[model samples]
Target: MHATLTAPSARRTRDRATLVCGIAGLASCMIVIMADFTTATIYERLGLFADTISAMAAGRGAMIMDTALLILVGGIVAIAFGLWRQRLPGWRWRAVIIALLAVAGIIAAIALFNEYGDGDVNDSWTFHYRLVYALGIIFTAVPLLAAHDLKPIDRRLWLGSYALGAAWFVAGPLMFTVPTGWDGLLERVAAGIMLLWLIGASIFLIRQPDGR
Candidate 1:
């Protein structure tokens, strides 16, 4: 009887953890949006549509944006751990978890080594731009890898992930081709796609029947 009781208790604990992580994932999305807009207001020359988030972190509101990014890292890490506890089958699922952690690390690095201000050009020596490039690759890879695994859990999420990945493949390259003033807009669109997947995946994890 004690063993059986412990099993249910453990399951409940996992459920609660997944639930908290899901909420954290959602909260992280809100924090980034708020930080971007708040910091944009601090700079007279900053144009939200024309200025990339890196510009916000590199300029007048560096402290605010950097601090928010650190907080965002914690939230993403939580979501990664939440998924890790699920013990999903196959290498694809494992790859998804690894990608999520990599993304969190990249975000933290970006905050640490922010890019040049909006008007400045970043050379090859800048690790910030290199990290951004790496992030774009791995971030998009997560949804594509996880899409197959998510099929058994939720068909809609699986389809959404596949579609999101496909869209990123096209849009990611377009970001660089866009005019100077438009790159920022495209950057945000790319980020929004990733965040949407993160939010949706977290919700599905929270709703899992067994909370595994």
Candidate 2:
């Protein structure tokens, strides 16, 4: 006979996994950033900009970059699955979870199909890679928006998600107007904001009591 599924236990496990993966992913990114000893300032070089690193030949930080990205993508996929396992209240909630999963999938794709090498921006893979990255950023906020419905008590969390989304939207266009040196800085800010939102949401999910 098949064993009966325990909803509460399953939910706790999922929540814990989500929290752990979220933190792990962020930590991996930080490690990658620190390992990069390039002369370019953080502001001058976009945070984790694939083109600046990940080259097979000249990539100063390729090993750490690839390792961190693999870890980050794996963690993201785990977190997305964890969120999906939860018993969302309605179809709308389910759709949100699916969207989050899609975002994670896209990230995984980017990690798998990375830039050819440093200064490989003109390549077709690099072009698609950049496009997917932008799309991922745009959709990152959907889970946060759906979180508003999941956890009504935490008005601040959902509001923060909306704010991040708006900021990302505005920042994308504004980056072009800013000095070229600041492009990396702007991209980092947008990415950092999204990561913060994920961290907050993961914490909230962790603290929720069973059956929530």
Candidate 3:
């Protein structure tokens, strides 16, 4: 009877791992989305409050740069752990890094048009908000999309989150005709969805066996 119980427990453990991996993958995407939106909020400050904050940020641009780098690393780690735990060896660190560099480059290029680039101090720094957002989006989307062993629940959560990626992509060029604030609204929607997905995944996984 004890041996029979142990056999069932071990199988249950394996099943739990699948759930955890799925949760990790979902969390990774959500984290990237949240971080990206955060950087965008800081970037889109055309109001007095934004100007004040940007002024302060510009004064210590290097600090902001360092902070962005730290987040970049943290994002990478989260993504790697999610992939490893979930048995996705292919879309691991290499994917995260390549996506990061590409997205960062795009945002940095866009930052040149902003007011911050007026001085040498700003030029010395490399924390382009757009680049970060792009990186966040790509990294989050790629991992979940490519996660090989996704359970049905994982697919349900991620498929919904993937729509935001499309929404942001479509909204990007549309900003030229509409208002800049329009992008902010879309980002807020994306942020909310990402948060909800992460929370939901957490609740689903918390009760499952940790060994799984």
Candidate 4:
């Protein structure tokens, strides 16, 4: 009887943790979206279509963007641990956790190194561009990696993950093909798709009592 009671108690504890992490994930995305929007609007000369997000991070109000990145890192870390507690079969859980943690590390680095400071202090700019590209691929893969597991939990989310991947491919790789000045627009398109997947995935975990 004690063992039986313990099992349910532990499960409930985990469920609460998963729920909190899911909420963290959602909150992080919302915060970053607001920061991006606010910062983008602040610089009137910086064309939203022509200037990259990195450009927004470079000059004034960069602190806001950097702070958002750090918050995102925290959110990703929570999601990684939360997913690890779920019952994903085979290597699905491991893959998802690795991807989430990797993203968290990358974003943390971006936030710490920052785009301010003169003349590439600590060579942050060099690391920045490469990591940005790496982020596009790895983040896009998150939905693809977890789609199989998500199918059973939520069909709409499962289908949406693949759809998000397809959009990411177009926005990421094909951005270069769509005229030079429009790259930023394409980048934002990819980012929006990513945000959708994050929110969907977070909701999936939040709604599941056992974090299925």
Candidate 5:
């Protein structure tokens, strides 16, 4: 009886940890959806610079604004989780990185929208894209690698997903460069791909454990 009770107690603790992570992940996913919606609209305004999201501004801005609010609220919730739960150092860093990258991605998307297909890439725009992509990639992957705080299966998922992510970012300089025409679809596409990838990884990181 004592052994059975101990097992249940331990299981409950793990379940709680997993639950918090899942809640956080779900919150973060909502933020990404908001950001992506805005991006699609802005890209539309930019003339389908991406596969979708071509020529949407007011709508996109509204979405981005909503996303920002969601992110802020999510952060508050996350902070409460961290404070109340025994989060691992790895999990803490993961949360921090996720926050930073999401913010940077939003800023980059907005900057691109403002550029509005000037037909000329400015130094600042160029710099922001490079920095945003690189940092986003690194942050998204590193935390996955360090995510030992999670269960063994979660750690494995992090390893596989992040490895591909890391490889993608490392090749950014070569794969993503300035476009030569009125439509730099490739560059925009790459950026979109990175955002979605990070979003997916973040979701995985945030998910609550099952059967814990």
Candidate 6:
């Protein structure tokens, strides 16, 4: 009886942790976007296409974005851990967690390096930074496709993930073809897809019973 009771208690704790991490990840994304818009200067507009959000990590009024990114990284790391605890079978879930952690590492690197301006566009660090961002999103989505097969995950959730993944994948290429001022708009749309998934998944986890 004692052993059974302890198991249920532990499961409950894990469930709570997952819910909290999901909320954290969703909140981090919101805070980052808010900071970027709220702190923008008169000349800068959130709708302008500026490559990565890190483009604003430096210069005047950049501290809010920088700090928000750091918080976002922390939230991502926590979400990865929370997913790992779910122990969904097969290598797919493991791959998902690894991919998220890798992305978190890249985000941290971006925060530390600080993109100044378009001058060093051809620099080695800049190249790697952009490459990693592209790779991270691709890798993250690939694993997510496999997650749909996991029994514990809601079918609707996985379907939503696939839809969002497709949108994000397409949005990146669309950035190059859109009108001059639309780059930022497309970028936010892509990022918002993933953020919506994070928020939905968190709420799902919170509502699920301790087991199953």
Q: What order do candidates take by lDDT, descending?
A: 1, 4, 6, 2, 5, 3
How many clashes in each candidate?
0, 1, 3, 0, 15, 1
Pull out the clashing pairs in model 6. 49-184
lDDT by residue for model 3 over 1-212, one digit each (tens)?
A: 89987998887776676465555545555554544445445653343222322332344343453344344344334334443444444544346435534544443443333345455556432544445456455646543443323334467645654554455455444433445535445444544443453444344444345543
Give lDDT per model, in order.
0.82, 0.56, 0.46, 0.78, 0.49, 0.66
In model 2, what is the error at residue 20, expressed in angstroms?
4.7
4 or 6, greater by lDDT: 4
Worst 10 residues of 3 by lDDT: 47-56
In angstroms, give how far residue 133 of model 6 lies from its true place: 4.6
Q: After superposition, how far is residue 211 of candidate 4 from its true place, in Å?
A: 7.6
Which pairs clash inside model 4?
none
Name the Cα RMSD for model 4.
2.5
Over 62-174, each residue of candidate 6 has an lDDT whose tens digit, in order, gives 67777887887887787777677766777767777777777777777667666544565448565654855665465456436545654345677667777767776776677
Off by over 4 Å in 4: 116-118, 121-125, 177-180, 210-212
Off by over 4 Å in 5: 1-17, 38-46, 50-137, 140-144, 147-159, 174-208
lDDT of 6: 0.66
- For residues 1-212, write the lDDT of model 4, one tens digit per residue: 89997998998888898899889988998998888888878863566788766667776867888888789788878777777877688786588789888888987877777753357677756677778778877877787878877788678878988888788876787765777688778878877887887787677668767535
Residue 119 Cα positional deviation in candidate 6, in Å, after optimal superposition:
4.2
Tell me the TM-score of each prediction against the true structure: 0.90, 0.68, 0.44, 0.88, 0.48, 0.80
The residue-by-residue lDDT of candidate 5 on 84-133, one tens digit each, is 34455655555645555455455545534444343545664565455556
Candidate 3 regions off by >4 Å?
1-69, 89-115, 121-144, 147-153, 175-177, 180-212
TM-score of model number 6: 0.80
Clash number for model 5?
A: 15
Number of backbone clashes in candidate 6: 1
| Candidate 1 per-residue lDDT over residues 1-212, each given as its tens digit | 89987998898887888888878877887898788888878683567778888867777889988998988888888888888878888999889889999999999988876665344545623666678789889988898998998889778888999999988888877887889887888988887887788887777766764544
Report the C-alpha lDDT of model 2 over 26-53, residue by residue, as the tens digit: 5645554454434233332543443333
